[model samples]
Structure formats: C-alpha cells, structure tokens
Target: MYYKEYGNTGMKVSAIGLGTMRYDEQDVKAGRFEKCAEIPLYALENGINYWDTAPFYCDDKSEIITGIALSQVKRSDVYVTSKTNFSTLGDHPSRDDFRRRLETSLDRLKTDYIDFYHMWCMLNLESWERHMEVLYSFFEEAEREGLIRNIVFSSHMQGDDIETVVETGKFKGMLIGYNALNHRFRQSGIEKAYENGMGVVVMNPLGGGMIPNHPEAFTYLTEGTDLTVPQAALRFVASHKEITVTLAGCTTKEHIDDAVKAVENLEEYSAQEIVKQFEGKGASLNNLCTGCGYCKGCPKEIEIPKYMDAYNQYIFTGKKKSILDRLDNHWDISKEKVLECIACRKCEEQCTQHLPIVERLKEIGEIS
Candidate 1:
C-alpha cells in the first residue's frame, strides 16, 4: 500500500484507508464477528493502516467492530480516526462529554488514543461559528490529555464557507466530497487548504456509487481514458497533488481489492487532460448544480438544489424509486411548492455557475 503524509501531523497513512460503514450490516448478516473482521484485518495485512469510522455509523457498531479487529495488532502499528456530531456536544461543553465519548469509543474499539478526531459533516458558516469555541477547547483538552493526536473536520460546504474554514489554519485535515462529477472544490478551497498545511481527504470519491456502472456518469471519465469508470474516478481525485487520501466505502472484499489495485498503480492525470475529459462529456444543468445551494434563499421557498440532486441521482443511476423515497422522507414542502416555480428566471441570474435554473425546475416539476 502506498502511504501519504497526513498533513503535517507527522503520521503516514495508506492512500486506500478502510471505511467501516459496511462492517455493521455485514457482521450482522454473516452471523459472526470474523466475517466482518476479516475485511479490515485483510486491509491491514495488506499494509493499509488508516481506519475511519463514526459514532453515527451503524449506531456506533462500526467503531466496535473496528476496535475488535485492531486489537489483534499492536496498537502502535495502526491509525484510527473517528468523528463526533456537534449536536451531541451541546452548550456548556465539558471535558466530561469529550472524555466520556472518547472512553466509550476506546472501549468499543478496544483501543487507547485515537489518531484523529473529526467534527463530522459541518455544513454552514453559522454551524462553524456556533461550535468553533467548543470544538477547539475540546480538541485542546483531548490533545493535552493524550486522547487524540490530531484535529480535523469534514465539510460539504461550497464557495465562501469552504474558503472561510480552510483559511482558519486550525485543522490538521479536511475531508470534502470530490469526484469526477463533483469538481467544485478544485478551485480555491482545496488549493488553500493544502497551502495552509491541511491534509485533504476526499469522501464520495466515486460520486456515492454514481460513477461505477452508470453509463451517463461514466461518459465523464471515459471520454479519452483507457481506464474503467471506477479507476478514472479514483484516479481523478487521487491525481490531485493536494489530496492525501481518497476514502472508498467498499462493502465486499472484491470491491476492496479493486480499489487497492487501482491505487497501487495510480497515475496522475494533468490538469489540462482532466478538464478536457470532463468537458468532452457535455455539460448539463445537472452538472451545473454543484449542490452548493447559493441560490437556495429563494423568495418562493423552493428547495432548489435538493430537488436537483434527487433528479440527478435518478437520471444518473436509474434508482428512481429510491430517489423518490428519499425525497418523500426528507422533503416537507407542499406539492404546490414543488409545482409553483413561476419561471421568473431570477434563480438562473443569481446562480454562481450561471445554470439555467428555470428550465431545470420546470423539468423537475414535470418529473414530480
């Protein structure tokens, strides 16, 4: 396994890290711990030392399984990273909460100190400012107490908010969503984060499974490359000089093998070649919607990007029922709100990427 320096934290982590989201279900289905444990141990035996998990994953079962697997190895030989949601941190944050969570995680994982502690899925500017003090304080205490070695945060932020966080110079690492279909971060956000000594870890590297077999999505990467869609997608993100690791969520051993093989012989594609490959695929309104939600404060109260995301997911993967089911579960807006787009063309004018918003909304309303 090829290893990369994890920012300036003085730790080298595998380019292909083991993600634990699949372990909980797999463990339950296989009716044995060895079934779930095998994948992670196989990864470690193959020289993968970076393991990432979260308390929210499988209701905290992921960390438990990870801990069980790593206990077989000497603690100093591996790295474990986990995250806490800010909502759980609460107001009047105490070391007790931090310590309790750490102890619980350690006990579940059967390990001592975590190599990295991340604030997971931070979305907006307000959320950042709201939790910054408590976050910093908790990290400071944890580091001083020898509970965690590094501090990081993962963001789905776009535009200025991403820039704001990267410029803070507080984090040792930043995990963001990046793939062949999602290249919005390659602008100032990723470059600035690297410049500030922050390790860039990519999530949704296959565009959340949208790139693997979806011909429409595959077109973006197969324009001129000999690589398969998955390989191209993996290489596209891994090729970035700033990216330290691209996190792949693989369920089966075969999936893990494919990812490791891809990384083993990964080649850097030049910036011009990268741009040309995506350009030849032809841009759609779907491509234009970076899901940034810059135009979301619409007076009509339209959930602009959410609907677009659902539509893109449906069109890209042919998972229409699943997409609609998700939309029904999460979207509280009325049917009128869904159909009430007046085609004022105001949203298109305000779009940062100059997307034809009115046309896209019309199509979405028709679909619904």
Candidate 2:
C-alpha cells in the first residue's frame, strides 16, 4: 500500500511493484496463461499499482497475461512498464520498426499507451551508445506522441558506467539489479540517477530468489529483526530514499502479500550501515548467479541458466545430489548437457555477474 513519487514525474508508484517474469513454468508451458494472468489481477486488486512485463518474459506470454489482467482494471489505476531489448530489436531497427514494436506492446498490454517503456537490458556504454544512435530519437518520438509517458532503461552494468548513462540526461527513470549482495557495486549509479531527478526502480531485489532460497546464508541481513530473510531483502532495497520501487517477481497471491507486507513498516537505514552489515558476506554471494538468464545464446545450445541454477543448489548444500535433483526435477537438464559446455566463454562474457561459468560447468561435468 505504500507509494512513492516516481522522481518528479508527479506519479506515485507502489513501493512493491509486481514483476511478471516468474510466472509458474507449468502454466506457461501448458498454455494456461489465464491461470498466470490471475496473479497480476490479484496483485492489482490488493494494492500493487506497478506492473512490469516484457515481450519475452514467461516464455513470451507475460505481456499477454498482463494484458488479460489490465483489461479488468481501470487503465489509470495502474502504471504499466514494458521493454524493447536490443536482442529482439536487432542491430539496425528503423523508426518504423520501433513504432511497430511499441504498437505490438500496446496490443499485448491491452493499453493504448505505456506508463514507462525501457531501453531494456543495457549492458555497457557501447550498447548504450548503440541504442542512442539507433533508437533514442524514436523513443523521444514515442514520448511526444503519447505512446509512452517516460523513456527509461534497465541495466546490469556497474555504478560508474551507469552514472555515465544518467549523465546523458536522456531517461526519465531506470531499473537496475540491486540487492544486499551487490548494492555496493551499483550504489553510485543509483545515487546519480536520484541526483539527476530520475526515478529508480530496483529489480532483482531478492537477488533473483537467491536470498530467500538460502536464508541461512544471509541471516546477517535479518539479524536482530523480526523479518524473514526475504522480507529483510525487500526492506533493504525499499528503505533506500533514492529508490522509487522494489520489484518482486511474484508468482502466487501469497508472494504478493509477502512483498506488500515486507514494506509496510520501512525503517530508514543508512546505506553505510547496510553496507557494513553485509561487509564480509560478499565472498559468499558476490559470485552467486541470480538466474537472470542473460547468459543465453550459448553457441553449444547449452541451457546455461539451468546449469547455473543447479550449481546454486550445489553452492548452498555442497551436495552433488542437490545439483542433480535440481537439474532433473526442476530444470529437466541432463548431466550430458552440462558436459556440453566447450569453454567458449561466450555465456560468461554476457553474464551480468561475470561468474566463472565454464569452470562451474567443468565441475558439474565431473560429478558422478
């Protein structure tokens, strides 16, 4: 129920935004998007006013499911955010192509206009420049045409580079990956965005389910508090004055309730205090893969995210059986696929966390 100003844009967004990327896999695979659609509807009814989706999220059904939910609500009641990624838009997208993409998103979201449209998945200055050269003016045109209210971007780059992006003064907002494990790494960019009067939304607030899945590994974040580890993680991002929203990739109604509950009573904590609290914990988590799936496009056709997620199980429990169980039951990736990684390091190059992915694959391949 808590809301904050989205910068000086005169829009107040929910402190806990609903992210549509983590809808139930079975529902998506079985073409039961109506079941997936209900979660966003439930979230909107329950006080979440911000809904973020994209074309490819949830097996390319997120925007459709989001559209289904938005249809039942008054359009002005919620702020809708979607993205246009370079991977999808291609290297030389024309203005007409950009307009087409926007119109397609409008159709999928069941809205005539988007509240916020992002320069999705920006990785470095090179990519930022490329987008600016090829598509920034088109984004400006869309804003002027009332197709989108704000032009924003999402990034996984470090703070300094992101600060440079903010300095361009081209965006109205930004969504970045920030959590207890990596906030320090991206804090400067967040502060820069705030200083530039740009709205800052924190994605991957639960470290892409890492913090909740391994609560014991992050007890320091909740020590001396009545909050659960997930609650603590949510609070850590929401408590920041610079942050406009902390997005939780909620799949169930309970997840929505839990996310809403986590921010009900936010305490003002100093950034340094949070940093100091998590000072020594970096070694355990800085290298942890968040399952963001940016590491796709493997030349060998390996499902890198699945193996990295399985590796996470091994990291937590130190049991080969744990990794095997995750690959078999949850991911459906076989050990043979794990062994297929040819050390091309292509995935590692694209990885947001720059994890030792090939080495991890080697270790997984040697298992049993």
Candidate 3:
C-alpha cells in the first residue's frame, strides 16, 4: 500500500506494482479470463495502482485480462502499462506498423490511452538505436495525440549500456531486471536512471522465480525480520530509494495478498547496509544465476544457462550431487558436457552479472 513518487513524474505509484504475466494457464486457455482477471482486481483493491502487461504475455491475453479488471475501475485510479516488441515488427518497419500495434493494444485493453507505453526488450544500444531510428517518432506522435501518457523502455542490458540509453533523455521511465542475486550487475543503470529524473521500475524482482523457489538459499535477507523469504526478497528491492516500483508476477489471490503485505509496512533500508548483510553471510550470492539466458550463443554450443542453473542448485545445497541431479533430471544435459567449455569467455563477456562463468564451468567439470 506504500506509494512513492515515480521519479519526477508527479505520480505516486504503488510500491508493489501488479505484473500481469503469470495468470493460470488453465483459466486463460479456457477463455476463463474473468476468473484470472480477479487477481488484478484483488491487487487494485489492496492499493496497487500500477498494472504492467504486454502484447505477448500470457499467450497474448494478459492485456485483455487486465482490461477486464480495468473496466470496473475509474481510468484515473490506475496506471496501465503495455509494450510493443521491436523485433516482432518485420524488417523495414514503418511508422504505420508501429501505430497499428499501438491501436491493437488500445483495442485489446479497452482503453484509449496507455499511462505507460514501452519500447519493449531493448537488448543493447544497437537495438535501442534501431528502435529510435524506426519508431521513436511514432511514439512521440502517439504521446502528442494523448494515446500514451509516457514513453519508456524495458531493457536487460548492462549498467553502462543502460546509462548510454538514459543519456538520450528520450524516456520518462524504465523497467529493468534487478533482484537480490543480481543487483550489482544492474546497480549503475538503476542509479543513472534515477539521477536523470527517470522512474526506475524493477521487472524480475524475484530473480525470475529463483528466490521464491529456493527460499532457504536467501535466508540472510530474512534474518532478524518477520518477513518470509519472498517478502524479504521483495523488500530488498523495494527498500532501495532509487527504485520506484517492484513488479511482482502474481497468479493467485494469495500471491497478490503476499505482494501487498510485503510492501504495506514499507521500511527503507540503506544500500550499504543491505550490501553489507550479503557480504557478511552470503558473499557469493551475487554469483547465483537468475537464468536470464543472456549467456547463450556459445561457440562450442554448450548450454551455458542450464549449467549455471545447475550451479544454483549446487550453491543452495553445497552438494555436488545436487549439481549432477540438476543437470540430469531438470536440464537433461550430461555432466560430461561441462568440459566442452573452451574458456573463450564469450558467455562471460555477455553475462549481465559479470559472473565468473568460465571458472564455474571448470568447477562443475571438476566436481561432477
């Protein structure tokens, strides 16, 4: 229920924004959006005003379901977000193509104007420049026409790359992946966005379901607190002053309630103090992979993300058997393939967290 000014937007967004990507598949496929739609309604009832969705989320029905919930509420009471994927637009994309996508999004959402319309999935500066080249003007035209209130982007690029994007001053806000496990990688980007008076919303605040799945691995965050590991994980991001909203992908009513309670009695914690806690008890926490899959395109064709996910299990249990089991049972990859790494450091170079990927691969080779 705690609200903070989203940068200098003059809008006080809820600390916990409802991320509408995780609706129940059965309900969604059965054309049962009314049931799944209740989740966001519950979130709104609990003081969440920010609802984020996209064209392709939840089998391309997330925006429709979110629109169902928005129908019952006054438009001004909620800040709605949706996105258009630049990659999906074919080569030689035109302004009309972008506008067509926007019109479709508006039709699906049953709303005339989106509070925040994003240039979705800016992977690097090159892609960002391409988006600017192809569709930035269309975004501006839409904004001037009152079809979108704010122009923003979502990225998973490194801190320096993100700073470069912010320096363009083209956006009012940004959504980036940040969590207890990988904050160091994206810290500079978050700070730079905030410094430039841009709202910074965190997308994968739960490490893409890794933290909640293995709560025991992050006990340090909950020490001396009444919060569960998930709440503590959420608070870890919400506690940062630079962050505007912590987007949680909620499915059930309980998920919405838990996200609400996590930020209801919000407490701001110093970045240094939170970092110190990690350094004291879990210095290696930052090395744990969130399975972002940025480390693909290995020249040797090694499944790097799968091995790193296995590494997470190893970190959690401190058991070599866990690593072997992870590779065999979950990833269905042989342990011997860990030796395929040529130490070329391609994956390392692309890693957002700057993890010692080669070193970890070597360790996995030795242990497994």
Candidate 4:
C-alpha cells in the first residue's frame, strides 16, 4: 500500500485505511471472534497501518476483536483510531464521562493510547458550540498526558460549521463524506481545510455502496479505463491530493482486497480527470443518484434519492407514469405533498452538486 503525508501530523498514513464499522453481524453476534478478526489481520498483512473503529460498531464488540487482531501483529506497526460520543452523555457531560469512554475503548483495545481519538458523529454546528469547551479541555489534557496522539472528528455535515472546526487550529483531522457525487458540495471547504494545514479523512467513498451495486448507472466510470465502477469510486476519493486517508468499509476479505487494488491501479490524475469529465457533460444527474444520501434531513422527509431515481427512470426509459405511480403509491410521496417543501434550501446546502432542488421539485412530473 502507498502512504501519504497526513497533514502536519508528521505521520505517513496508508491511502486505503481499514474502516471497521461494518463488521459482519452474524459473526459478531455468534461470537465468531476469529471470523471477525480476519479483516484487520488481512489489512495489516497487506501493509495497511491505519485501523479505524468505534465503540459502537458490531454492538460494541468491534473494539475487543480489533484489539485482539492488532495485538497479534506488531503494535507499533499500525496506527489505532477510534471515536467517542461525549455529547451522548448529555450536553454538559462531565470531563470524567469523556475519560470513562476513552478508558473503555483503551481497555477493550488493550492499548495505552489511541493514535487518533475522534468526537464521533459531529453533525451540527450548534451542538459543537455547546460541547466545545469541555471537549477542548479533555482533548488537550489527553494529549498532554499521552492518552491520544491526535484529535479529530467525523461528520456527515458540510459548509460553514465544519469550516469553523477546522479553523480552530486545534483539530488534527476530520472524517467526512466525499465521493464523485458529493465532492461538488464540499470541495471548496475541503480545499480550505488543506490550506489551513488540517488532515482530511474521507468516509463513504462509495456513496454508501451505490457505485459498486449499480455499475450500469455510472457508465462514465468505465469510459476510458478497465476499472469497474467501484474501483473508479475509490480512485476518485484517494486521488484528491489533500485527503489523508480513504476509509472504505470492508465487511469481507474480498472487499478489503478490492479497495486496496483500486487505489493501487489507478493513478491520482486518472481519478481526478475521470471525476472532472462528469462535472459538466459526461455523467448527468438524470443518469444516477449515487444514493449517498448526503442531501438528507429534509424538513418534509421527502426521500430525495427516491425522487432522483424516478427522475432518472423517466430520462432513461421515458416512463413518466411509472415514475408518478411509484412516487404516489410505493413511496407515498406525491407531487402535491412535495409542494409542501418550505424551500428551506438545507438539502441544497449539503448537496455538493448544487442540484436545483426547488426548481426540480416543480418539474418532478413534467416530461422532457
């Protein structure tokens, strides 16, 4: 595996880090520790030095298994990363609560200190404002005392709040969603984060498994290369010069191998050029929605991706009535109800592509 400079941390992280959030449920529940253990070992054997996990994955069993696998290998050979939900202990959680969670992970992982400790699922600006002081104190003390090597946070949020956090000059990194489709919405912010000398880690590089399962939907990925759509997706994110790691969720050994090979085979420029081709002409929105769901939290709960799918069908199949019937019956979303949208523009803000949501809602039923 290849390594990249992880911002100003003076660490060289593997481009394809193992994201351990999607452990196999059957294996985890059945207590097949060996089965679940295979992935991390495979990753380590393949020179993946970064292993990322959280306390909640696999019903809080992931840390235990990951800790075991890491112990079997050279401890100093791999970087251990995990996340915590300090806010879950209520808005004004005591600093002890933060330490308790960290200690729990440490106990489970059998490690003295984590290489990266993240404030898990940081999705809101207001919540950060409420929790910042205690968190900052906890992180500062943790680092000074050598409890964690770096401080980072993960989020599905885009725009100014993320910018605020990155600008604090405190955090070492952030894990956020960035793929071909989602890049348009957050590229500027990501670039700015690079400019500020903060490490950027990517989550959901596959658009939550859309690109792999629906190759026909993204033929642009196949235009000039032998890459399957999913390989193209991995390449797209890892190719970004500022990104420190591309964290792909691998539930199977094959998944891990495929992710590694994708980055290995595709040059960074090839991925960048392929994504750019789709920007204006190559891949139209009507072709595929990618189903990443970054354009979520709509006030009306309109299920925006379903609408996009219907819209895509209409464009490809010329089946307007089919689109209408499914939206009206199967999804229970009708043109009339869609009109209820407050035009709040929240979805558009999260959307990297800048899809004209309000205008498209008006034309949901109109034929091309």
The model with the greatest TM-score is 3
Error of 4 at 262 (Å): 0.4
Tens digits of lDDT, candidate 2, 69-172:
89889999999999996677877888888888889999999899999999998887888889888988899998998999999999988899999999999999
Tell me which residue pairs clash in candidate 1. 67-109
What's the residue-level lDDT of 69 in candidate 3?
Answer: 88
Where in model 4 is the C-alpha error above 4 Å? Answer: 269-277, 281-368
Q: Work out the TM-score per prediction.
A: 0.78, 0.88, 0.89, 0.80
Ten-residue segment with the worst summed lDDT in candidate 2? 265-274
| Number of backbone clashes in candidate 2 | 0
> For model 2, what is the C-alpha lDDT against the true structure?
0.87
| Model 1 per-residue lDDT tens digits across residues 122-206 | 7666667767866678777887888888888887666467779888787889887777665754445777777788888887777
In candidate 3, what are the lDDT values of residues 1-368, reduced to their tens digit?
89989877899999999999899999999999999889988899999999999987899999999999898899899999998866556766788888888998898888999999999888777778888888899899999999999999998788899999999999999999898877877888888988899998998888977988987778888887888999888988998888899999999999888888788678776565667657756445667888877788999899998899898887778787898898888989987887888899988766756679999888888972
Rank the candidate models, highest lDDT first: 2, 3, 4, 1
Deviation in Å, model 2, residue 222 alpha carbon: 2.4
TM-score of 2: 0.88
lDDT winner among the candidates?
2
User: Over the stretch 1-368, how does candidate 4's per-residue lDDT look in tens digits?
Assistant: 87887889888889998888888999999999778988999988887888998876888898998998887887789899988765445666788988898899898888999999887776577656656766778877988999999988887566566787888887888888787656766676677678788888888887666556557766675667677788777877888877779997888989888888877754554334545666664344323455556688998888787786566555545677767876767677766656677889898665534467766666774533
Give Cα-based local distance difference scores for all models.
0.71, 0.87, 0.87, 0.76
Q: What does the lDDT read for residue 53 in candidate 2?
A: 92
Quote the positional error of residue 167 for candidate 2 in Å.
1.2
